[model samples]
Target: MALVLPFEPNEPSIEALVALVKADMERVNATILARTGSDVAMIPEVANHLISSGGKRLRPMLTLACASLSGYRGDGHVKLAASVEFMHTATLLHDDVVDESDMRRGKLAARKLWGNEASVLVGDFLLGQAFKMMVEVGSMTCLDILATAACVIAEGEVMQLAAAKNTATSEDDYLAVIRGKTAELFAAACEVGAVLGQRPKAEQAACRSYGMNLGIAFQLVDDALDYGGSQAKLGKNVGDDFREGKITLPVLLAFRRGDASERAFWQRCLEKGEGNDADLDQAIGLMTRHRAIADTVERARHYGAIAKDALALFPNGQAKDALMEAVDFCLSRAH
Candidate 1:
């Protein structure tokens, strides 16, 4: 039997916000397809395949939610939200190629289906398209934030590559990598919304901080799920990070807690980048003994609380409530 996880419905206000974002996304997608042209039809196809795949679209939704919470009532939010989605999609395309991942959202990855060369080129094209959209939005400040985020994301990827299979990675180092690779763009999304809304600089910074912390919590929970969640619920195979030799929070904690014999087992599997079922069971057992999964969950909850605290500066409203709900949702999601 396949595993199933529970999901709560979004808050009522979130439903309305989601509708607006979806309508805007369709328009933006149309614009992208038209710009790509008929001669490059495959580009649109591949792009659409990835775009239409079922994702929470959390980043773009964050842009919209933040803008609305700040009393923004303008059409420009749509374009800005679309820009976030484009940037996110571009990153996913490139990440799949880099990770050699075959599945995403329970579907074949764009790189796996269309080949890595096509995927990378399309990813670059999306990045260029995102910048073009930013220019059209006509906010120099927004552009600067996004451009800087792009650089930080690249740096984070490099940092992760260096940290891979290195069990000595500290919690602080892991936080830095997660902030760059995952949270920076999320921060940029909300920050751009504040810029568009002409919000106060301090409030804008708060929104960015909220997004950043929420993103870190989201990714941390994701890493924990890899160890604790079933494949049917997670939409991917079990022990994927183990197979890829990626050292995440649980593994780091487990290593720190391990004794001599347990440490030797990790050295063979993690250091040498090779593990079988028995090795995976041993690793899981060691992690359980160390209570690493619970520790990671505590870390995720801490960030989620920080995210909620960041919104305290904003006035109470349905949008603000929905934003708070999103933080709760991130911490509570089963997969």
Candidate 2:
């Protein structure tokens, strides 16, 4: 989603969180830039194409904010934050290849520009760098958290592949796909901060819960936007999910709620891979008729509320306030 937002006078803003972690974020950015360098020319070129693509880098920012809020004074959070970003970047590169996407963050996808082989190999290279940074941090608990997230994210991608183009994919199955693919990394990012702070297990768990819920909300909003938002706002073309036959939450809800004729349309467009530019319009109309996009956004709001609640144990401060606003910032994208 675009980082820019229309003015909402009373809305909570991510600016607070951005200001809160600005210094640490600088360090994380430096680390990311430094790590992208390689003797092989193509590696840095392909990696930097996405790393510098202005995608907001929210995942790494979460790590920094959580660390600051948890009172972590050490520098390990910098390395960990960079690692979180690399993992995310790697996934995006792989995702573009898998989905055969043309655009990302308003530009041609790295896979499209660099070819799938370069994209995948560079993605692997980034994964290696990410793991190296994680190891350098020397926190076993932190390492374990990120390592497990890596594995779970891979499993989630495979799960999504399995569920792709299947109109019968259930809501539970959809949730499982996102939990592993998206939320797992968010959970790990926040939890590792608490680990660095040597906070109590309860606080660590709370951080994980906050990130996990936020990630779910974030993905759900993206799903809604795929059918309901503008291309300029969404970065990628609208109806990308429909064209790719991805079984997202909006499609699942609409498919389950649609009439027999509606079901046939979805089946023909999604399951049978018969969708075209015109089918894209029909798909959006169907989603609107079924309240699919609206309900998907409503579900995001539900998770966003849960994410806010997850931070309840933390004392009220700039850190807490900024983190709270971050959730609002995520939800505000729907508007």
Best by lDDT: 2
Candidate 2 ranges with C-alpha deviation above 4 Å = 1-8
Model 2, 1-335: lDDT tens per residue?
A: 87987786887778998899899899999999999999999999999999998988889989999998899999999999999999999999999999898988989999888899998999999999999999999998998999899999999999999998898898889888999999999989999988899889999999999999999999999998988788888788888888888889899899999999999999999988889999999888888988999999999999999999999999999988998999999999998
lDDT of 1 by residue, 1-335 (tens): 97887978753233544654565556655664554443678888888888877677788888877877777777677677777787888888999999898898779999888999988998888888788878888889988999999899989988998887788899899989999999998899888888888899999999999999989998999888888888776777768888777889999899888887777777779879878878788788888889998889899999989998998999887777778878877778633
TM-score of every prediction relative to native: 0.91, 0.96
User: How many Å off is the CA of 75 in candidate 1?
Assistant: 1.9
Model 1 spans > 4 angstroms off: 1-38
Clashing pairs in 1: none
lDDT for model 1, please.
Answer: 0.83
- lDDT of every predicted structure (CA atoms): 0.83, 0.92
Model 1 residue 79 lDDT score: 72
Question: Candidate 1: deviation at residue 208, Å?
Answer: 0.3
Worst lDDT 10-window in candidate 1? 11-20
